[model samples]
Target: MDKDTKRDLHSLPKTLAELVGKHIVAAGLLVDEDPERAYKHAAYARRKASRLPTVREASGIAAYTVGKWQEALSDLRAARRMSGRDTFLAIMADCERGLGRPERALEITNDPAAKDLDADERIELRIVAAGARRDMGDVKAALAELQVPELKERRARPYVARLFYAYADVLEELGRKEDAREYFARASSVDREGVTDADERLAAIEGVELVDSDVEDGVVWTDVEEEADEAAAEAEATASRERRDDKGRDHRRDDRRDDRRGGREDRG
Candidate 1:
């Protein structure tokens, strides 16, 4: 367990802590192989110890794996509120995307502490940010959002397979089939563990299902957004300012373009 998680669990009574700890361990172990079971374990842990931030975090991740968008979002938000450390910003943004509210996903990525994400987290955030653009029906802008220097690196970095896969997916959407094929090939080469269906995509055997999340801005608004922001605000109070997420979403030009289409805020 991570130090913060250990510390959080330490405050619980011994018997409850042991029970929660067992479920947490099981969830982590099965999350990759049997996410449904993992979610059950994590959910049980959360039910037993809803006040524990770590348990909530685990539950949120487990639910996210199973595509329970609203449940994941709510638990993650609770985790952030209880811990005052918002490490799941990217996940929360993805949950917004899963919930078909990509604009809100983009807005979540604009939190001041966004720049404090570590490398892998930054990449995840960038992916979600690009996905939000795609969801808004701006394929060109979506491509621009993923214009990070790491895209060119030869050395393997974490999440590089997913990065290549996302880029290829966008290229396919824009009718650049050749470019998409190239990226899918690259993704397949790196994805030894088959995290994505890049192999099937490269073989042209996978069904091409295009999901559209195009909605006019200002047409969709949730009353609960304010509460989420307030929770994030409280989280920012405890986030260490010393850390920095080296990558910034390199999409200023995208924002300029989006401004003409719709008023969307830009962040570094």
Candidate 2:
């Protein structure tokens, strides 16, 4: 390997712990995309500095993303033990959700300890908590938690998307088809250029054929529907065999009656 090619990447920090912390922060941002990779980076960071709250929090988030619920909980516990701060409470709540303990997440969001958080932090906490509440079939509670005027008036696209999606999901679950459709459409329109997933969904909701799937009977059939073709072929073969057997039985009955008639005629 060329020494020049092995040059320092990302401007190595003066301190080894700082370099690890920076890597952990970078890995935390990748939880939604490359969870496994994020977990590896987070684990590396924690190995370098186990007492760092930020590293443990990043590990918790990455573990949650990769479906390691117990590991996530352990990381978050270590983070809280080290700092006693709520820097990553939202992600911790997400861990609880992944672990099938959404109610516990909700309880943490509602805890009095969250009252001292800043405006932005408060909103994030509420959103995370509401997600848990929504998962537990408490639509009203989730909506109530987010109905504050401050949050409603905010113009953050990501937050708006979260609110819209949560509201739409609740309405849809409650059989309020029109309301849910309207909210979903609103969410879809927040980004109209199709540069994001929300925009694509908006195009879909507005009757635009963006993906070429024709929906029928509340189900969509796509280009890769070979599984259905196999099942249909098997059904048709079974039906064909049944019909052939029925026809053979009818022919045999007709021949037996003809033989009986011939016997009677000979006797006469």
Candidate 3:
């Protein structure tokens, strides 16, 4: 490639600041499962929209997954400032907790600005706050943070799982082994199909199994049905072989009887 081609590629329209919002969204979606790749994409998006809050948020998420805690704190805080009261605040609290400053994390979540977080985001914040309190040796306060009203409702299984999982940690910390095991079991029940490390924690507590749900986005039902049908056909083919073996045993029995009858007739 020549210098002119490189310059043109670098100057592409999609690389421009004005058109980076959608790419930022895409970068966020990729961060959890593919952080390294997501980080590269987020970097490109940030180059185009460094001032955009979502761009910075995506960068922070990717960096956090890669264990770049300081970078995550900086980018997430910047995103929180630029976005002016976005979900990035809760995310930044998580970064604080990750860096072993749970008290600061709790303070961040309690900010009046964070009070209006949605159900899922609120639950997430509480989980982090609970951990921070636990780290601070406040076991009761940690459990209290996870005891929100929504946790008792079946419709809030995901949130409830998060609560139980966090509660289990506090229980374990306080040397309440049996209670911790029960809480861990409860967490496992609700966290099925989860991709997070909470599942592993639940398993360690006892009598819990992690069953991953395979729900792929953008995959067609028709394709799934075709795959199922193919599997069924293979199963049927195996059954057919078993039936043929049974038939071979019956044929051998019939041949043996005929030979015995013929020999008896010849003796007579």
Candidate 4:
């Protein structure tokens, strides 16, 4: 857990604090690999410490991860109220969209509190708002909504690639194939971490087909195949890290049990 979460739990009795902290830690650990189990952990923490805003936040995020839209929206709203922070507005708006309430999502973007968000948060809101417009079958309006100056930046920031990709996707939706291809290429170039599948989209636009090297008939090698291999390798690496983290937690639990048994022996 982070320092802020620890501080929030400080007011609880020691035993209760320890239990909630353990659940929260488990939730964080399992969230990526096993989101359903992570949601269970977060829910356990919420049950134990219902009054804690951080616990509510954790529960909300876990619910979101697991696609429990209603639960996520309720928990996130409670968290926002308790914490008096609008940091999760983007997720909240997304949850609204998840519930098929695009109009509600747009309403959230227009909220007075939205103005207080930082630059990154505002960009996130614009993205969601554009998505909401798309949900309403207004592709042109969606494209217009994403026409922020940040989208035209020459250098790539983490947000820029996603913004460009979103714009390109909207362009494609509106039958602007050439523009879509151009923007997809631009997005792919800036996407150093391969966060978006911009490369794949660009390849599809250019009618480039990729064939697996292990195919029996004919194997065609292309840059797209190399990119796919890299993506697979990265995914495997992430899974490996998650496994290591899970093992580390189990070892810690075993050590604690051993310590308790040793304490009993010492007392005897």
Winner by TM-score: 4
Candidate 2 least-lDDT 10 residues? 1-10
| TM-score of candidate 1 on Cα atoms, chains taken together | 0.71
Q: Write the per-residue lDDT of candidate 2 for residues 152-259, one digit (tens) a residue.
A: 443536556566665666666667777767766666555333323544443444444344444553234233345567789999999999999999999999999999
Model 3 Cα lDDT, one tens digit per residue, 1-268: 2232233334446546334544555666777777887788777777765665666777788888887888888988887786574576667788888888887888887888666877778878888888788778888988888778875645426767777777777888878988887777677667655623554565556544444456663112233455678899999999999999999999999999999999999999
RMSD of each: 28.2, 9.9, 10.8, 24.2
Better structure of 1 and 3 per lDDT: 1
Task: Give the per-residue lDDT of model 1 (tens digit) for 1-268.
Answer: 6777778789999998888898999999999999999999999999898998899999999999999999999999999998887689999999999999999999998778878877667778888999999889998988987778767755554488888889999999889999999888788778766678876677562333323345742122233556577789877854634223212333666666788666434332
Which candidate model has the greater TM-score, 2 or 3? Answer: 3
Give the clash total for candidate 3: 0
Candidate 4: tens digits of C-alpha lDDT, residues 147-205:
98887775766578888899999999999999999999889878776679887788788
* TM-score: model 2 vs. ground truth: 0.61
lDDT of 3 at 179: 84
Per-candidate local distance difference test: 0.83, 0.69, 0.72, 0.89
* Backbone clashes in model 3, listed as residue pairs: none
Query: Model 1: residues >4 Å from true position, as ranges?
Result: 205-268
Best by lDDT: 4
* RMSD from true fold, candidate 4: 24.2
